[model samples]
Target chain A: SKSNEPPPAPPVVHYYMNNLTNTRTPIENSETVLILTPLAKFYQEYWDNLLKISYPHDLVSLGFIIPKTKEGNAAYSELQAQVTKTQSGPKTKRFASITILRQDTESPLQSQSEAERHKMENQKVRRAAMAKARNSLLFTTMGPTTSWVLWLDADIIEFPPTMIQDLAAYDVPIIAPNCFQRFYNEEEKKNDIRGYDFNNWIDSPTARDMASKMGKDDILLEGYAEMATYRSLMSKMYDPQADPGTKVKLDGVGGAALLVKAEVHRDGAMFPPFAFYHLIETEGFAKMANRLNWESFGLPNYLVYHYNE
Target chain B: SKSNEPPPAPPVVHYYMNNLTNTRTPIENSETVLILTPLAKFYQEYWDNLLKISYPHDLVSLGFIIPKTKEGNAAYSELQAQVTKTQSGPKTKRFASITILRQDTESPLQSQSEAERHKMENQKVRRAAMAKARNSLLFTTMGPTTSWVLWLDADIIEFPPTMIQDLAAYDVPIIAPNCFQRFYNEEEKKNDIRGYDFNNWIDSPTARDMASKMGKDDILLEGYAEMATYRSLMSKMYDPQADPGTKVKLDGVGGAALLVKAEVHRDGAMFPPFAFYHLIETEGFAKMANRLNWESFGLPNYLVYHYNE
Candidate 1:
């Protein structure tokens, strides 16, 4: 019986892996970075721009979350086709790995059409749902080897190819880029660019005065004429003649493109679904970080373009 | 003297390399592949599509040659910007290496305007210069470790991500894919697709008869009524219901997306800039391969899209 037994099996070897001891800052390519994107609509341009990133693929991980709805299902199918085509090839053609999730909790505004979803009446519920989605994707995909986390929006269609390296080079606890968009200029008869995200800004005396008068359950919004906060927005700070590395301190941040050190998130910085210091979502995350004694920053001259629609 | 002598230098290490003893058929990922592209005009779509390829980047080498002309110089500058953005980051963000050459010999028609470049009278001269460019790029970049060579065109905008693996799976000495383009259909009020490259085809009795009657200096042109070859073009063989792997024997080949075993080129197969058997350029290259007893094959159903302009 012993003589007739089969030989022992051979060991399998894996060639690609994140460094197990990677606990350093993510300024170097040796440290792994996690990119988290919350998807509502899957645009081909967004996928194309993602592929255009010049960061090393082996050092980056991707995570996505789609809401549970009819439109969400269609987006998932389209996303699957791209993922399969990208990951089914040789080891070098794929990212470190990809993780996708469906939201566990459904939003009350999930059934609203695109035209109605952006109304002022729906902003509170819509943003709360998005905050939960980001936390779900972040907590589920991040691991000990992940030294950095980048929150990239799915609708961002254009950015510099060296986005990750440029953002991480600052080595700040957290940083946000000035987001802008291109539009047709009827008066000039040509295309023109304008600031898009008003969420990133420095605190103003008028904003603090307004927050002091607001109720505990109230939420503050940026760029609203009805609620004049008079904050200096980072979007308005873009100077083409200035150095791209120009930096500024910020009390609020936007979700379009935010880079954070893994330690900041580990210390409990998160996008709060409820009103925190009269702010919610990305601004709430900034408030939480400040409460933990970690400062937020912005690159006024380093620009990223958002989808016009 | 002994006290003043410098200590012995430390040894260096290299992480990426082609298999040194690799002489097998190149159907496996372990073998190295060299991609050669002769550039006249630089199209961003072509570069983007090249990046979308799912093949292993570490196992592939890239070669390019730009002509010496105003248009060529502008294209080179545009290409260099993209290359620096891609290759200046981490090691994984770059190809194995890129070798770019400035074509030594200038073409007589290099100064022709875009409108006059494709006239019937200029076809022979234009294509001959293109052939020379291809030969220069190929011979310079391919080395002993290279197991395969892919001749790609700069204007080809789209193809399957698995193109390299799919074409190599056939293990044929030389193979090409059917090239098509998208055009506006005036009658249908919609975008329509049609074959673009008519070079890849099978020999016919009529074509052979015409070749026999041609002078040594005369060049035969395909898809031209004045010089009808009556060949069965691979472009005309596309069938929606047919399998993508369907293959057919080919007597002529196109340079848009051609794949060849390294041994074929090593054995003296090349694009003839002058008339050979009444054919020139890619068609002449196919004729040369036939003389060496190597058959050319085409994937009738596997299609690649080219830029219309």
Candidate 2:
């Protein structure tokens, strides 16, 4: 499809000054494409909190993946009951049908050689498994009318009633709220607030450099690169009581609490069941979203609290 | 192509944190795909300066587009001679075939209605035209072995002989050098160094918000949005005489000079002929590359300078 010839050179002039901004499009209310691919055991806490969200649930089309872990089938059975009880509403409600899927865990890992499995890092397998599970949740569950997808982890122990409304206020393509938990302070001897999750961070240049040297399956999970990474540059703000509006650029996203624009998935960004840019699962999705010019960020204030061991 | 069903619900947990870094695979002596599409009046300057590069010319597969403008045919004819003279080398060199192509410029503006043309912001048409021309250049000229494609505008008059090496040193997917010019003092001007390009920036939230609202044909060219943009955040380095190693993150790319890894192009990123997310042409290509997980940057110390009238 190319011309094979030595065409003559051209006389050139310096015509070079370029600038244009993208038009501003404002939306009063964007429909939710809520997706929950949780592997937690607390069905009641997750479901009850889902009802507590200040936003109208009728506008929300829900989906989740029942990963084929040991407790997966039992969790699916109970969740079905919960959905049946919760499904009925007035005629004005336009909620699309609910969706649920299961992991095809028929010894998929057996496909790998014994040697390969033995050498595989635990984190890598877990990431791949989770990524696969999340992929199942999205591809099998997403409805056409959805505009945004809020990813929620099952183990969230506490949160305000206004989380969905608060995160939507940022209005960026992808966003993660800080996940923290209260614990008996070993030092203070009292319950204290802590910014517990380290997954969402602003990476240092060294981490960026070290990334290329790692294997595709070797994901850069948080709490591991703390020495080299700034680990949530927003954390440097040093305020446990930070304002809700605060946000920062993110290198990775924790699955616990996230809000994603559905258009990202519609544009072909998915949780890679395998490594993508050395990241899998949620981080891989974040990478995929960033690559597509839909920027990702994390809120500094804790919008949702996670269960502590 | 996607499933739509309201299957049973699944219990989900906070299988929350995930991270992975892209591996940095270093390449040594990647082959060059040099391209320049010019209007042809400055043919002599373009040819001579090209011969001055330190990298082996024999290793380059040069290509260009001569539009159907007035001097376009004449420029193509002369470039054929220059290619012949400069093409000879030992067998060890890896030069691929040279290429030349043409643009259908017969009243390109004639297609636009007179009222529409009068109301049009010139940047929109320029960006669209340039994007189309560049796409044609790459689609028509690039060969299989090309690992890198260096886009050079005809107006660039000065650059390091090690220009390629310096840029490749960053080892990222996409990069651009700061373009500037030396202007003599008509009165108080003592050959002041003017940093010519302002498209590169660290985007603020307002600009990001404004992006989705803009039309596709609307291109943010340099100098036009100095007030709205965080213009050339790298230009604050305050180095009229800084070293070449200095660099910074870029939000937009200037057309005067740019270096791109070919795989980014091969992976479906190109100068989008139509508007893509409020950007078209070079900036759109940068956006596309970034979406595919390639980081783009700019060198602050002027690696190249453009010619003035």
Candidate 3:
């Protein structure tokens, strides 16, 4: 359980998103933005990170999905209070709109066989729920003017306030930045960085074979990396590569921080709440998008830092 | 698990809800009706019962809360097909709108101690999740014109199409119909009438004491009823009573066919996703409502029959 894992390393600035030299165009030509996040924890940090986004508040809409619990309720109420105060204040900074929704999370079971089955079901169902949630938020809020949708996780601790502008410069239908979490390497006696979000990766023959032997309810995701083989996560490939401008083709995308053209979703690309081609949820979403003619790519050198536990 | 309980007897029709004699009044004076159902099964029967409602097609909005799973996805898809088909077939057969949502169910554990703790968490978290899902739906969909909200389960099979009208006729702020499920007694070889939703009940001093003595994380809702006293489900009282027009005061309420005035929710009353005064979820909602000056009552004579499993 990485419960004894070292603390996060200091934040690093490794610029990599798109090579668009003209960052001004992104802000000027910015279409209506809908920022959607499904949150379970890290409330304070999540709100602070949100405020750091460089996008203009008037053109951006904020959507939060807080799962049901005492903690979640507290977060929702507190966020509401903060938003209300900000809206009524003299600075005149206000979002286009804000919507808060509620959901629930199940505690993971502890057992061998039963836990394995529970793990599979939990993974499948949780992703499906997230996909359903993302879809619900997207469809309900997407208006005629919405040009892009950005998916962000609540636990992202570090990103340039201009992260939105950087992704917008790429002009991709679906794209994700390299994700890394800084951790103190006790052996090295110093904080070191490691690629964390590996959900987006190139498939390999070994992975296909491993996935093939699984049962109807079984899945071969990143957590099973020890048993499965994959070519590389974009973050890993980006770290040692010479070319930072090139985008890596990906078969899947994570919600950690992703930018998508609103049309891809409007055209019926969605995260399947059930397994599709042995992939479920977000990965299933990547499959669904590819089937619907949307190409997905990742910026390996361009990075976002996930909050290390 | 009430697995060995006696069979439910023949269906009883106690005339209730708003008298349909002036059925047109219900349609004309319809308060933007929102029928909320949290579903995991009985897809076909649910849709059939939904379609059978005599309320004006244009005034009634259908909301189904589906928990995340492969099975739930199938049900969601099936219901979508049914809704689309019904919507496109005739203008007279359309609901005002239909919204389907997703949540997750917790897996029961295997060990004795862990299972007990899991049981406590399951009861608290599952009901809390329901409360959260219910609140999300209510807040998201409650329009300025919405005057009433009806809570129904998906498995209920027997009810007059004018059931909504009947419940609305009661014209109370919060009211619950008696719930009964039919079961076959193998020993008696005869079907018996039994009330199944004992979640709605009157609190007793004995049960309250037991609940208080228990840990904050512990509850004695349904399964623990055998071990704890102080609360008795209205279903138990209804079965033995012969009166035709009797109403019982309740400190708790279930979603199995309930009618609530919109103001109660608008005025800051909600289904507390956590325990309130030893009650959780829907019951907590009942307590919250009473605290807000809204009275809760259930008709012991007027009944709704659930499909026997």
Write the candidate numbers in order of decreasing TM-score: 3, 1, 2
lDDT of candidates 1 onward, in order = 0.74, 0.59, 0.64
lDDT of 2 at A87: 62
User: What is the per-residue lDDT of model 2 for residues A1-309, given as tens digits with 9 covering 90 to 100?
Assistant: 012222222222111101001111212343444656554254587777776766665556666655555566677777767766666544333234455544445323433332453343555675566665665456434433345678888777677767776777777878888787767898878887676666677767766766778864455655553436445454444465656577888877777788876655544456655555666678777776675567888888655777666
Ranking by DockQ: 2, 3, 1
Q: How close is candidate 3 at the interface, in terms of C-alpha RMSD after superposing the true interface residues?
A: 25.1
Report, to 2 decimal places, the DockQ of model 1. Answer: 0.01
Question: By DockQ, is 1 or 2 better?
Answer: 2
Q: Tell me the tens digit of each residue's lDDT in model 3 across B132-184.
A: 56655554445333456888887777666877777667666788988888888
Stretch of 10 with least lDDT, candidate 1 chain B? B9-18
Runs of candidate 1 with Cα error greater than 4 angstroms are A1-309, B1-29, B111-115
The recovered share of true contacts, given per candidate in order, is 0.00, 0.00, 0.00
The 10-residue segment with the lowest total lDDT in model 2 chain B = B14-23
Q: Tell me the TM-score of each prediction against the true structure.
A: 0.47, 0.45, 0.48
Worst 10 residues of 2 chain A by lDDT: A14-23
